[model samples]
Target: MQLSLSDKFHSEMARLCPAPLPSVLAIMVSGGSDSLALMMLAHDWAAEMRQDPDNGPVTLIAITVDHGLRPESAAEAEGVAKIAHDLGVDHVTLQWKWDGVGNLQAAARAARYSLVQEWRRRKRPEIGAILVGHTRDDQAETFLMRLSRGSGVEGLSAMKALPLSHKAADAAGAAPVIRPILWASRADLRAALQARGMGWVDDPSNDNEDYLRVRTRKAMRDLAKIGLDVDTLTRTADHMARASVALWARAADVARDVVTEPYPGILRFDLTRLERIEEETQLRLLAHGVGCLTQAPYRPRLSSLEALAEAAYAGRGATLQGVQSFVQDDALILVRELRAVADYECPADGASAWDGRWRIKGRRLGEAVIRPLGAQSLAALELPKGLPKTAFQSYPALWAGQALVAVPYLAREGLCAPQYDPSAEFHRSILSH
Candidate 1:
C-alpha cells in the first residue's frame, strides 16, 4: 500500500482530468503527514506530466499557511519549504494570525483558504483549482459529525471533488477547492511517508480531546467493533450522495417549468403546477428560492423549513431564512423579508452588492446610501406598473439624506441598475446546498 502511493495519485488525477492543462497546480502542504504525502505525490505527477511530449507543461507550487497558533508553526513551515525546494518546486509561506474569533479551527481553515486563494488570484491567476489533503477518514468523521447534528441527505452526502462552484459569486477569480486524495486512507498515507524515511510535523492538536474531530477519531476504533468502520461510514455517505443527485435533478426539472422571475429578487411559481409536484420537490424548490434571495451560505433548518412550507403552500404568509412568502392570484410569490434588510444600509460609493441578491453599479454620490424601499418609501411614490406590492417593499433604492434618488428595479432605462433572476441560477444551486 505504501509503495502504491504514486500509482494511486496518478490514477486519481487521470480519472478526474483526462485532458491536462499547462496551468500551475498549487498544492497545500502543512508539514503534516497527509499534506506531505500530497506534496510528494503531486511532485511526481507534475514531473510525469511535463516529461510527456503530447501533454502541456505542468507547474507544481507548494503553499504553506502558518496559522501561528503554536510556536513551532513558523519553523515547521520553513522545513516544508526546504523539502519543496529540494524537489525543485516553488514554495511560499503565508502567515495567518488568529484574531481570537469564533471556533479557532474553523477560523483557521477559512483564513488559510482565503489567503491562498487571494495569493493565487494575484500571482497565479491561470490556476483553475487548488489541491488539498482530505482523506477517507476525514470523510467518515465529517459524516459522523453531520449525523450528530441530525443532518439530512445533503449534509450527509459525500464531499464533492469540486465544492466551491455552488456559490453565487463564483464569477470572481476564486478557484474551486479540490480534494484529490479522498480515495486514500490516512493510515496508508502515513505509512507511505514512513517508507520514504521522511519525517512529518505532527500537530499535537490532533490528540487534544477538546476538538470534536479528535474525539471522533478516538471513537472510530470502538465503533469498528460493531462493524461501523471508516469504510462503512464513507460508503454510507456515497449512498446518500447518489440519492441527493437524483433529488436535485427532480427539483431542477420542477423549477424550470413552474418558476419565473418577474421582478428583481422576487420568485413567482405557478401555484397549480407547483402543487402537482411531490412534497420533497416542493421543499427543495423552497430552499432554492430562499437561498437565491438571501445568498446565505446554509439552508434553513428542516423542521422550521417544513413549517414555513406548510404555511406558504396554504396561501398564508410566512418567512424563513430572511425570505418572505405569499400567495397572489394563484401564484406563490417569494421575496426578501423586509426585516432582513430594514437596517441594511450601505454607502453608495463605487460598485458594491446589496443583500447578496443584487450587484449595484452607479454614479457615486456623497453621503448617499443603498437600502430597501420600506412601506413608507413605497407609499410616497407611484408603484411601478404591474409590479406586486410585496416586491415593492423590498426594492433596492438609492437614498441621499431623506430624498429617494432612484430605485434600481424601476431604473432599467438608466445606466445604473442591478440584475436579479432566479430562472438562470435556480437549478445550479439545487444540489449544491
Candidate 2:
C-alpha cells in the first residue's frame, strides 16, 4: 500500500529537519509535479504542527517564477497562485524580464532569486527556511549531464540539498535555504500527489528535443534500459559533491593567497606567487578570482584557461570575454577596461596633413569646406551660415560626401572664426595636437 500524502510529508520532514518546527517556511512552487507535491506536503505538515502549543502557526508562502519564455507562462503563473490560495497560503509570482544579452537560464534564475530575496526581506525578515523541490531523479540527471560535458568535480557534483547562502549578509540575515525533497524520488512525489488527488501542469518545453537538458534526459532513459540503477547514480552524485566541496575549499584558499581586491570590481594578483602554485591550481584560482570580481559564473573554456595560464607565466597580456589580465610594473592586473591610445592625430590651422592616414584642412572662417570621411562617416553635421564664431565652434562637424567639410570651430559663429581671437588657446591646442 502507498503512503498517504500527509504521512509522506511528515516522514520527509522528519528525515530532513528532525527538529522543532520552524515558525515560517517558503515553498517554491512552479505548478509542476515536483514543486506542487512539495508545496502540498509542506501545507499538510504545517497544519498538523499547528495543534502543538510550543510551535506557532506556520507562515507558508508559495513563490512562482515565470520565465516568460513561452506564451502560456503567464497562465501557468496564475494557476500556481490560485492553487496556493486554495491551499490557504500566500503566493507571489516573479517575472523574469531584462534588456541585455545574458544566458537565459542563468538570468532567469538570478531574477527569480532576487524576487525571493526581496519577498523575504519585506514579509518574513526572520524566515527559517526557503524550500525548493529537487528530486533524486533530478540529481541523477544533473550528474549524467555534467559527465557527458566533461565537467570537473564541481559540475559532476550536481545540486546540493543545502546549498550555502549566496546572498549578502544584510539581505539574508539568519534564514537558511532547505531542500527536504532532494532525497525523494520523482516517482514518490507523483505518488504523493496522486494520493492527495492534486494535479499539476506539464511543461511542454520538457519534451522539446532542441534543449540540451532534454537531450540529456533522453540519454539517461537509454542508459536506464541497460539496467543503470537511478539510486546508484544519486549516490555517485553525493560522493562527487563531497569531493567538489574539498576541491573548492583548496581553490578558495589559493585564490585568497594570491588575489587581492584593490578596488571595487577589480582584483590584483601577485604573478610570482601564482607561479609557485601548481598549474591546475593556478588555473582554478584565476578562474575563481575572476568569477568573484565580476560576480559572474565565468567558466572560461579549457582553451581560454590554458591561454590565460600561458600568458601569466610568460608575463604577457591576454584578453578574456569581459576581463583583461596583464603584467604591469611586476603586478598582474586583472582589469575590466584597458585604455588604448588613439592612432590618428588631429589636424591644425588652414590645411595640415599628417601621415597619409588622415588629413585636417581648414578653409576661410565663413566658407569652410566640410566633407564626410568615408562611405560611413563618423557623424553628420548641419550648420547655419553667417553664425557668430563662438556659436559656430559649438556646432558639431558635419559629414559631407567623403570628407568632414564643416567643423564647428571654423564656422562663422565658432570660436575659431576670423572675426574673433584667431589666436585663441582652443585654436592653438587644436593646431598643436
Candidate 3:
C-alpha cells in the first residue's frame, strides 16, 4: 500500500513535532511550490488536530515577507494571501522596505527574518517555531556551494532540521527556526502541490547565473548524470550533519570541563586542560565560547579560529571576534575587547543589552549611557578589593555625564547590575555527556 503524499508529510511532521505541539505554528510562505505545499499541509495538520478531543486548538499562521526588490513581489505576496484565505489560515505580509546597493540576497534574507521576528514579537508571540520549506534539494545545493567554498564538516552538513538563531537571543526568545521537510525532496513537494491543484511562482532569480547558487544548481544537474545526484549529495550532508552533532556533543563536554564564566561578558578556560583536548574539540570549544559572548549567528571563520586556538594553546594572547584572550594565572581569560565594545544607550523602560554582552537595567538610568568600566571611570570609584583590575574594564556600568552612577558587578550601591543569559549553552546539561 503506497501512502499518499499528504500521509507522508503528516508522518514527517509527527517525527519532527511529535506530542505537545506548539499552540501556534507559523508557516513561511513565499508563493513558491515548496512554501505553498507547506501551507496546505500545515492547514491539514491543524484540521486533524482540531478533530482530536485531547489535543488543544492549534492556530496556523502564514507569514510572507515582501523584500520589495522586484516589481512582482507585492503581487506574489497577494497571491500567497489569497491562498491562505482559501485555506482559512491567518496570513500576514511584511515589507522589508530598504534602499541599498550590496549583496541583495543576504540583505533580503536578514530583512525578511527581522520582519518575521518583529511580527512574532508583536502579533503572534505564541509561535513556538517558524517553519520554512527547505527540501533536500536545497540542502544539496547548499552543500555543493559550501564544498566549493572549502567548508569543513559543519558547513558541508547543510542545514539542520532545528537550527538555533542568535537573532532571537537579543529578543530574549527561544523560538527555534525549523525546516520539517529537510528530508523531503523538492520534486516530491511539487508533485504534492500539483495533486492539490496548486500553482507556484517560479522566481526569476533562481535561474540567474549571476548568483552562485544558480550556477551551482545548473552544475548539479550535470553532476546528476554521474552518480552524484541530489539524493546522494543530501545523504552525504546527512552523514556530515550527524558527525557535526557528535562533535558538538564532545565539544560540550570539553566546554563543561574547561570553560566557566566567572562574570557576565567574561569567559575563563583552563588552558592546561584545553591544551590536552583534541585539536578539533579545542577549536569547537573556542568557537562556541566566542559565539556565546557575541551571540553571533555563525561561528568565526575556521582559519581564524584555528590561528586563535594555536595562540591559546601556546599560552599566547590573541583577539578575534570582539573577544580578547590572554593567559592569566594558568587560565585563558576571554573578555570582550574594550576597543570594539559599542556604547549602548539605556532604554526608558525595560532592560537593554549592551554590546551583546550584558543586559543593563535600572530605574534611574534616565539620560544615562551604558558602557564598559574604563580606567578613568574606575579611578573615580573607591574601588573594590579582590576584583581583577585587568578584567574590570570589560564590566558593564551605567554612566550619567562624567559621574559613574553604577558598577553593578562590583556591588556598587544604588546601581543597576547586569545578568548573564545562559541561553547560549542552555543545552549544556544534555551535551555535557
Clashes of each: 0, 25, 0
Which residues of candidate 3, in runs, are more than 4 Å off?
163-171, 313-316, 347-351, 360-369, 379-390, 413-417, 424-433
Assess candidate 2 and give its lDDT: 0.63
User: lDDT values of the candidates?
Assistant: 0.80, 0.63, 0.77
> Residues 1-433, candidate 1, lDDT per residue (tens digit)?
4547788888888765556453777889999988999988888898899888777888888999999999999999999999999889999999998999699999998899999999988988887678899999999999998898899998899987663233435424377777889989989998988988878998999999999999988998999999999999999999999998999888887788888877667788787898888888887888888888887757788887788767766878788878888877777788889999998887665345566646555555556678988888787676655446767788788887877887875643253555543322565555554
Query: Which candidate tops lDDT?
Result: 1
State residue 280's C-alpha deviation in candidate 1, in Å.
2.4
Provide the TM-score for each candidate, comma-separated: 0.85, 0.65, 0.88
Could you tell me which residue pairs clash in candidate 1? none
RMSD values for the candidates in order, in angstroms, are 3.7, 16.5, 3.3
For residues 244-270, write the lDDT of model 3, one tens digit per residue: 889988777667778886765667888
Specify the highest-TM-score model's number: 3
Off by over 4 Å in 2: 1-23, 52-54, 67-75, 95-110, 118-129, 163-177, 227-229, 252-268, 297-302, 319-322, 329-331, 335-433
